[model samples]
Target: MLSTKRAKSVEVRSKPGRIYTVLTTLGREIAQGIIPAGAVLPPECDLESRLGVGRGVIREAIKTLSGKGLVSVRPRHGTRVLPRRDWSLLDRDVLNWLVGQENPDRELLLAVQEVRSIIEPAAAALAATRATKTDLLRINAALTAMEASDSQATATAADKAFHLAILDATHNPVLQGFRGAIDTILSAVFVVAVDSVDGWFDGNLPNHATIARAIEERDATKARDAMEQVLGYTQTHLSKPKAGTRRRAGRTGAGRTLSQT
Candidate 1:
């Protein structure tokens, strides 16, 4: 008689949050070019030992990375790192890892802002027409939180909330489809920019308030204009060198995961 044994799925089991640790460590190494493209990753057993995690955790991390286009795994060939161009750079975890790097890439951050400028203004215009009272209230509430925030981190969270609220107000699924990608870009852009510069969060409050007010008044043109102004400031801010640094002028360029309301 054939025995019926339930097969268990492999998961992270070495320690609490070991999977995250492995993912972050390896992700950063790849992002920073520590593990250069075309280099094969260390063997699974080696990573397990080095990271002090079990094989299950290591495999899971590698599987996740492979899905992000960071690595290619095959039976005969070992896991090899892929070129940065192949990576899903807009992936949330990958963006977060990039932000966590010792010196985040400025050029990448600029690219994010460019994408935002293209999408956000159009969404804000749609939001002015489509937003309900509840949407307006949410946008207002986010602005309120920004006003009340005592620290840069708190304010940045509220800032992200304000923008996300506007996007939600658009009520266009086609536009909303861009949300996930936008979220990743905004997070990496905001965190790196804010952490590097003091008072980075100060000037943006008025711009956000203007956007919310325009949407509240159902003025699509003004909403779009205000939104552009907000993003424009961000572009200018990112273009300038950080205070106290003479970084190259050519070089360019939030905080949470959210469920749809």
Candidate 2:
């Protein structure tokens, strides 16, 4: 049973999207470790009283969390927070909850980068072989947006679009299906990287351009290499101390220049 204080901590006022509000509040607590694994949630009645939401809404929110592997609801056992290992880390909501925490999980962020390192280079290679003119245009347009972005928010969106455009160009339905997961993780990474590392967005533009140019020329090898180089810049930015640890460094200069083939 949740303590009275703890239950009150998550209380919600009636509003539109009440279910989503309840879901996010509870999910954020779980993700941020305020509610640790193995802790059983309060009974439905208690939650109903505390959150001021209908029982059905609470059930639905728990059901959705269960689908994300964040909880296990057993007959008579109540709902228990599942171990982090059991979470569907790539699920859009889960990733958002995790990375949106005040102190984002460093290990999880690195795992996102690792996933990108494994997938994006290969996707870029495939796009080089299969991307149509329209696909290339989308990629170039995203790059142009990144170059012109004056705010961190716009730069982050453009950066995500640039990567997503390459993934779409692969023309593999299975790969294309990863769009939601990829978009969420990229947003998380870009948000953190841009805030933490000076010139994270602008410094990586040349690498992104190399990827676009290689795909346009149908050079699979160059595209893959350029994509890897772009990811390397991400790795560097992610590895740096988070913002405010030190004075923001001078604009992170471009990394190893990718020679045009």
Candidate 3:
């Protein structure tokens, strides 16, 4: 008679708090593009045995990542990474990890800026009309820091805080949902533009001030125009395609990874 253990049926055990490790390891693989998107993950029993973990731990880890838009689960389809577009760019942890990936592509960086152009100005206008006194104070404080800072990193920090404050002022979760993409765009745009301009703070403060003033006045059109100016400036210096470049895979940066969200 064949032993029962010889059958493929599996048992899952609950270890301590190590479930997070499995999640992170999977997250890192997702980030590094090691595992391509749309690939179905192994079954629970298979994954648990391969990862040397209990079924409970594997399930929890999968749930955590799934909620973050990193993985998808279907009864017949198993689990898969969502497409990059479906990824929650607003997730702070996800944003940080994506940015930290090696030599991320410039086109991807520019795409982030394009997404910002679509979302941020409207958010700013909304904030202008809706911001409370406390929100205004926070906005002013962030602007003050940016205006006073002489260093690139410090100024970028201030600029980032300023935008975040504007988003918070809107008090609309839908509007606020683009925070991670906004932050990524700001960071990458600053990195790119810093090379072409001297004293990045000095170069940008005028535009920032104009935008802030328009927001303070609750002038939606003016705010949008000012935002347009900022985007125009960025595109002028950073978004241009060189003469010899191809459509895709042309940029000499770490290329994009295709994955499920």
Question: Which candidate tops TM-score?
Answer: 2
Which pairs of residues clash in candidate 1, taking residues 3 or more apart in a chain or in different chains? 187-254
By lDDT rank, best first, the candidates go 2, 1, 3
RMSD of 1: 7.2
Which scores better on lDDT, 1 or 2?
Answer: 2
Off by over 4 Å in 1: 1-16, 177-202, 245-261
For each candidate, the alpha-carbon lDDT, in order, equals 0.74, 0.80, 0.68
Residue 43 deviation, candidate 2, in Å? 0.5
Clashing pairs in 2: none
lDDT of 1 by residue, 108-152 (tens): 778877878888999998999999989988999998987766554
Best by lDDT: 2
Put down candidate 3 lDDT per residue, 1-261, tens digits, no spaces: 355654423332234456877887787677567777888777899988888887888898888879889899888888998877787766765665565444445676666667777777787778778888888888889889876664556666788888888889889998777776677667755554544433334555677777778778888778777766666666655555433422221112332211000
lDDT (Cα, tens digit) per residue for candidate 2, span 1-261: 578766756654333378888899889889988899999999999989989888988998999999999999999888999999999987888888998655667778888888889889999999999999899899999989777665556666787788899999999998887788888777666556545745555567788899999999999999999999988877766777776753322223443211110
How many clashes (backbone N, Cα, C below 3 Å) per candidate? 1, 0, 9
lDDT of 3 at 124: 75
